[model samples]
Target: MIILKCQYLFNKILSKFFNIYTKLSFSQTGEDLIIQFIIGSLQLKKVTYLDVGTNHPFNMNNTFLMYLNGMNGVCVEPNPKLFNQIKRNRRRDKCLNVGVGINNEKTSTYYMMENSLLSTFSEEEANRMEKNGEAKILKSIPMELININDLIKFNFTTCPDVISLDAEGVDVEILNEFDFNTYRPKIFCIETISYSTNLTGVKSEEIINLMSKNGYKIFADTYVNTIFIEENLFN
Candidate 1:
């Protein structure tokens, strides 16, 4: 009877431990969970990906998840400071220190907020903050711009299956720049933050419409990022 009681207690302990683990895993935000689910569905054992605006090479990234699953990709970051950090963490992936934009010529005066998270390519956004008494002037550096077509031709031997865009306030511009007829990525993860007192960018509905027009549908949405998949491919 003592042995059986001990076994029951052991089973209860194991059950409690599993429950805690499951709660922690599900506690991840919707975006992170969707990213994991998409990667799993893609069966990304050896596929390639492109991460635009890779800020920090943290473990929470879909790109990092790809790396963990034996996949490879490029991490493009425009911020010199952030790029260096990404390079340090993602030693195996190709890291490009250029901003992806519509034009190829270098542009200056891009404003970065004090917090860095509110950095943007839009001067209007910066000026608005200055008017509101919540901004500081930081020296802007000239950033090399590359379009999607150029990136694919220059960087990849073949086009990547997935492309994740996290450009602050410029997600739509970047999405529009891509010629979907020729280079339709199977999946996309884009950041769309609602307009707030401190933050300004494209809304979730706008991004959803743009993706829908391009034959993609919203797979999932979180506070920051939205996951889209090709309708025909996933339907």
Candidate 2:
């Protein structure tokens, strides 16, 4: 814990002093640094983000770096355990223990995978991964499942500046349901591939086309996740 604090402090000092020239990524593949670079170029002093299916508070989290920079947003996690961890680490953010879904259901079956990060609400995905020996289902529980637009409308006065979504198999569903016309998030970092253990996951053409149609261009593709920037903002 002490080491983490020291590292956090060291990282903050470097970022504040040297700007984005110095960065420490807590994302799966340095996505946060890329996000920070883009946000740095913006005319804004602070930005808001919504992390859907946000598994961790800091470790391997997409928005933790921004939190350390004194920015706050909302984090949605269906797993109670993970939600507790996020609430503890990110006291500044509004952390909710709920799942993001496309339907009007109040709750969904939350599949807790053996590898917690791969957990999902999709039975098909859970079964597929378990069959492939990638990860087994540890447990299943009913959790609150809110619609994509409802999430934003309830949480933010306007669209968040960034939305980091990784709802396992439901990433595209949530993204598709988002009200792009009403709310325009500046950036979106979404898990854009089917999960796999043997490196055969297929890329999500649906997500790519959806974002493109919404006027957001692909800024970077980290395989695990794809980062998109608003066309107007990118220009």
Candidate 3:
């Protein structure tokens, strides 16, 4: 997530003299590291999480660092190819090869894009990606769907400590379905920037407002994503 974290650690002598202070965050931004800092400061020995639209296990993944640190949780990915890879590498996690949907649908049409990261269950989103020249739709498949509430209910006894969600364009829809009253996650790292090749990408204000209305405040905004912490956590 952190680009050139050791940006200052370059030159020949410096490289040999000092170890590169590498970036451990796998998030597109330094979201995982930020979340880790906050949660680690809480002094909890362990934490739990739920990663939605987990495209890759360790690449541009918001929850991978936590996994490496011994935190356990579930990963939901619709693309079977990606799911298999995550399941293989994240052996300790409960990897579910299914799409998250607003309603409890038996199955939904999932579009696999040329760039797997652009894949989505929303036909409109898939079409928009192709129309905008962001990516090409490689193929489509009927993937099983799961409700967010049901997901948390079945996977966790209480609620997970963190929910790192990046469901392409349906992220807010998923959040809207999350039973916040029943379960309150302490932190959330969500992809809040719209995808764009040019400089046309815009922040999702709706998401910011929604989180605020739910008594969460922005912990950090890295342009690509935003990290939120429940206000009560400070109390």
lDDT of 3 by residue, 166-220 (tens): 8888988988887778888899999999988775789999999998988899989
Model number with the top TM-score? 2
Q: How many clashes (backbone N, Cα, C below 3 Å) per candidate?
A: 0, 0, 0
TM agreement with the true structure for every prediction: 0.78, 0.94, 0.89
- Report model 2's TM-score to 2 decimal places: 0.94
Candidate 1 local lDDT, 41-139, one digit each (tens): 766555788988776675345566555445778998877887898888677789998887765545545566674655667777666766776665475
Q: Give the residue spans of candidate 1 off by over 4 A.
A: 1-30, 59-62, 103-108, 133-135, 195-202
Candidate 1 deviation (Cα RMSD): 7.9
Model 2 lDDT tens row, 120-229: 98899999889978898999998888898999999998789999999898887777788889988898998898877777899999999999998999999999899999
For residue 102, model 2's alpha carbon misses the true position, in angstroms, by 1.3
Residue 186 CA displacement from its true place in model 2, Å: 0.3
Clashes of 1: 0
Spell out the clash pairs found in candidate 1.
none
Which segments of model 2 are wrong by more than 4 Å? Answer: 12-22
